[model samples]
Target: MAQNQFSLFKQKFFSSFFITQALGALNDNIFKSALLIFIAFRAGDELGLNSDLLNNIAAGLFIIPFFLFSATAGQIAEKYEKSALIRKIKVLEIVIMALAVLGFFLNNIWFLLGILFLMGFQSSLFGPIKYSILPQHLSDKELLGGNGLVEMGTFLSIIIGTVIGGVLIGFDELGVRILSVLLLVVSACGYLASRRIPETPSAQPYLKINWNPITETWRTFQYARANRVVFLSILGISWFWFYGAVFLTQIPNFTKVSLNGNENVATMILATFSVGIGVGSALCEFLSGRKVELGLVPFGAIGMTWFALDIYFANPTSSYIGELGPSAFLSQDGAVRTLLNCAFVGIFGGFYIVPLYALVQERCDKSHLSRVIAGNNILNAFFMVIAAALAAVCLGNGMTIPQFFMLTAILNAVVAIYIFSLIPEFLMRFLIWILINTIYRVKKTGLENVPEEGACVVVCNHVSYVDALIIGGTVRRPIRFVMYHKIFKVPVLSFIFRTAKAIPIAGHKEDPELLNEAMYSIAEALDQGEVVCIFPEGKLTSDGDMNEFKSGIERIIEKTPVPVVPMALQGLWHSLFSRKKVNKFIDRLKRLRTKVTLVVAEPISPDEANREHLYTVVKELRDDKP
Candidate 1:
C-alpha cells in the first residue's frame, strides 16, 4: 500500500531543486539574450564590433571562470557544508543581479561583459557542490528522477528566459528596465529556494586546497582515471556538450539565413530546441523505467545524428530576396517542417545526455566526487569552446549551413565509433546481453508484479558468484551489483563484469574506504536509473541453505524509491562452486548438472521488503522445483 520512491520526489525534492535551478537558468538566459541583443543593436557601431566577435568573446568570457576556478571550487565543496555553500552562492546571485541592473542602466557593454564572466564564475563554483550534495539529500533511487527533473527544469527555464528576453526588449526603454528588475527579483527567489535545500556534510573536511588549476584539474582526471569506465563516461558527457554547443550557436544564423526571418523567428527556433531537450529530459525516468539506462545514450546519439542530417536535407531551396518578418516564414511550407525536425533532434539529445550524466555521477568515486565533477566541467567547457571554434572555421571555409549540419552528423558517427571502440565495454555488454537473449530463452511473470521501479532493497538468495551474473544476464535491464571488492577482480569474468559496470562493495567494518565507495556507488547508481542489485546474503551460499539477509539492503531501500525484486536460484547448488563439506577435493570437480533456473518474484515495496518477508519469499522461490 506504500507509495513508490518516485512519488517522494514529487512531494519533496522536485519543487525545491526544480524552481531554484530553473530560475537560475532563466535569469542567466534573460540577461544573456538581452545583452546579446543590446550589443547587436546599440553597441555595434560605437564599439565597431561585429556579431561573430562579440559572440566569440561572450563564449570566451563564460568559459574562462570554469578554467580558472573550478578546481578551487571543487576543493571548497569538499571542505565546507553544502547547504551553507548553496545559500552563499544564492547571495552572490543577488549581488550579481544588482550588477546586471547597473550595467543595463549605464548601457555599458564592457560592464555587462564583466557581469557575464561573474555569472559563469558563480555557476562554476556551484557545479561541484551541486552534484556532490545530491548523494546526501536524496536516497539512491531518487537520484535519476532528481537529475532528470534538474535537466528538464534547467532547459525549460532557458526557453522561457529566451522568449521573455526577446519579447521584452522589443518594448521601449521602460520595458527593458522592467525586465532587468524582474531578473533581479527572480534571482532573489532562487536564493529563497536554496534555503529549502537540506544540509550536506563535507566529504573531505581536511583536504588541502590546491590553487593551481592545472594540478587540481589533473588530480580530478587522475581520480576518474583510476576507474576506466568512469573515465570514458566522462569523455562521453563532454562530447555531448560539444555537440550541443555547435547546434545551439548555429540556430541564430540558421534562422536568419535559412528561414529568412527576423529576430522573432530566431527565437522560435531556439524555443523548439529548448522544448525538445526539456521533453527528452523528463522522458528519461519513464523510458528507463526509473533506472539509469545507458543504452539510451546510444539511442539518443543516433537520434541526434538522424535529425541533424535530416535538418540539412530538409533545407528549403526557395530563397527570399529581401528582409521579411517571422510571419512570412511560418506561411512557407518548409519552414515549420524544418523547425520541427530540429526540435525532434533536441528531444533525442535529452535521451543521450541525461542517463550518461546520471551514470557518471552514480559510478564515480564518492570521496573525490566534487573534484571529479569539477574536472568534468572543465573538460566540458574545453570541448564546447573547441566545438564553437571548429564550427566557425568550418563555416568560414565556405561550408553552407546545410553542409555544416551534415558534417556534424557525419562527425557524430565517427566520434561514437571512436569512443565505443576505445571502451568496448558498452558494446561488449550489449553483445553478451544479445548472446544471452539468442542462446537461451528467459521467461518471467511477476516482474511487473515487482513494485513499479522505485528505490527498494532487492534481496536474492546467493547460490553461486554467478548469481549476480545470472540475474544481470536475465533481467530486462542493467542492475548495479554490490560485491566484495576481491570478487570484482576475478579473471575473464572480472574484466567482462567490470565493463558491464558492477559496483564493488566492502563492508564498512571490514574496509572503511571500500564501504564508502560502495555507499557512494549505490547512491549514484540509484540516482542515475540503475538497479542496485545486492545479495543480502552478502556471500555466495556455501551450502544449499540460505544465509541470513543483511540489513544493508534495508538501509538502502529506506533512502530511495527503487523496488525490491526478490530472486532465488534453483539447482546452482550442485554446480562447481557449491559446497561439499565432506572433502575439499570433492568440491573441485568440473561442472556437472549445469541446468539452472533463476526464479524472480514480484517486487516488494520499500515498506513491504522487510528482512523476514524477503527471506520468506526467497526461501519459497529457491525451494521451488523445475
Candidate 2:
C-alpha cells in the first residue's frame, strides 16, 4: 500500500494493528514451539518426564488461562482504552520474555512453564481487544478486508514462528540464549508497534470489573447469547478451532507414522497447512465483495469437510520401509493430493472464519462486544482442549491418524447442520445468495443512493416473485420485506423470509388484521432504523406488464415517513420464478445464467413517496426494453 493512500483501513488501521497482532501471535507461537521442541527432543527420562506427557502438559497450560481469565480479560478491556491496554499487555510480554531469559539460562522446564502460563494470560487479555476493537477502527465495508489481513498475518506469523523455534533450538551452545534474546526483542518490538496504534476509547468505560471468574464467565456467555446470531457465530468460530486443532496436532505424527517421513516431511505438512490458511484468509475479501456474507461460512465448512475426507482417503495405504525427507515424500503418489487437501482446508477455513468474526463485530452490541468476544475465546479454548483430549483418546484406542481425519470430517458436518438448522439464515442465505450471484451476471448501479444509516423504504418493480430475493441478496443492509402472505409462505424461501424478518401482508378485505400488523411491523422496523422493502406493484407481473401501483406505499410512508429508495430490476420478468409461464420448466432452466441489472435511484422524500411516483421512477429506471 502507498503511504499516501487515503483509506484509513489500508494505511492506518490494518498496517499498524496487523503488525501489532501478528507480532503478538508470533511471539506466542515462538515460546510455545520452543517449549514443545524442548520437551520432544531434549527433555525426556533424564528430566523425569515422558515426552508425550510433557507436550500435553505444555499445551494444556497454555490454553488453561484462556478458560480461567477470559471473563476478567473482557472486563478489563471494556473498562479501559484499548490502545493503552494493548501497550500495557505488550509491556508485560517484555517482562515475561526477560524472565524467560533467566529460565533459559538456568535450563529449567518448570520455570519456562510458569512463564508460559503468564504468556497465555497476556494473550487472553489481548483476545477481546483484538476482535472487539475492529468495529471501532474499520467501517462495515472495511471489516471483511481488515479481518482477512489480520487472519492472514496471524497464520503467516504462526508458520514463521514455528519454523524459527524449530531451527533455533537446534543451534549448539548458543541456542537457548539466542532463543531467549529473540523472544525479548519480539516482545519489545510488539510494544513499540502498540505505541503507534490509534487510541480506541473503551466502549463501556463505566463497566465495573467483576473479580469472580466463575460468575463473570457465566455472565459473559449470557451476554454473548443475547444476540442469537452473534452467539451462534462464536460457536461456529470455536468449532473451526476445534477442527483445525485436531488436524494440526496430528500433522507431525501423521507425517512420521502414516507417511513414514522425516522432520522435513512434518515441516512440509505444517507449512502447507499454514500457507493454505493465509491464502484462504486473504481470499475472503474478494469472494465476499467486501461484505460480511454468512454464505461463505457454510461454503467454507462444506469445503473443510470435503477436503478432510479426501485427505483421509489420500493417506498412504501401504507403509514404507524408511523415513523420507521432503524430496523423498514428494516422490510418493499421494503427496500432491495430501498437500492440496491441506491447502484447501485452510482456504475454506479462511472463508469460514473471516465472515464469522466480521459478523460478531458487526452484530454484537458495541457496549458488550469485548465480553462477547471474551465468551468466544473461552469457548474456543474449551473446544480446543476438548479436541485435544478427544484426539488423545482416539489415538490411545488404536485409531489411526487417517481415521481421526474422517472422524473430524463427520463431526464437522453434524455440527454445521445442527447450527444451520438452529439458525437457518446461514443456510438460507448461502443457497439464495450464492445461486443468484452465480446464475446472474448481476450489475448494480447507483448503490450509493441508498442511505448509509437510518431507515428507508425500498420500492422496486415486482417483475418476478424472486424480485425480493434478488434485491434483498444484493442490498448490503438487512431488509424486512413487506410481501403478500402467500408469497412469504413459499417453500424454502418462507424460512428465509421469516429468518430475514420479512413482513407478510394480505389484502385488507381478505384479512384486515394481517395487513394492519404488516403495516405496523413496517413502521416499527423503520422506527428502529431498519430497511423495509416492498414490491409496490403488489404482485408479480403476469405477462411482463405492470400492475397499477397500489396505495399501500402511501400508508407505509404516512406511518413511518422514511426516505424511499426507488429501484428497478430489469431482465427478471423472463426468469423462471416470474409469472410468465414457460413452455417447459427444463427449457427455462436452460437460462441458467442471465444478465440482470439492478439500478437504484435517488431517495425520494417521504411526502413524495407515493405509489404512482415510485412506479414512475422505477419504470423510468428500468428503461423498458425486451
Worst 10-residue lDDT window, candidate 2: 1-10
Candidate of highest lDDT: 2
lDDT of 2 by residue, 413-451 (tens): 999999999888898788866867787767789877888
For each candidate in the order shown, give its overall lDDT on alpha carbons.
Answer: 0.76, 0.85
**lDDT tens per residue, model 1, 144-200:** 666777787788888798778766765758868888889889999999998887667
Error of 1 at 215 (Å): 1.4
Candidate 1 regions with alpha-carbon error over 4 angstroms: 1-14, 46-51, 316-327, 428-626
Q: Which stretches of candidate 2 lie over 4 Å from their true place?
A: 1-9, 45-48, 174-178, 316-322, 508-514, 543-545, 579-590
Give each model a TM-score: 0.73, 0.94
Please state the error at residue 598 of candidate 1 in Å: 9.5
Model 2 residue 262 lDDT score: 86
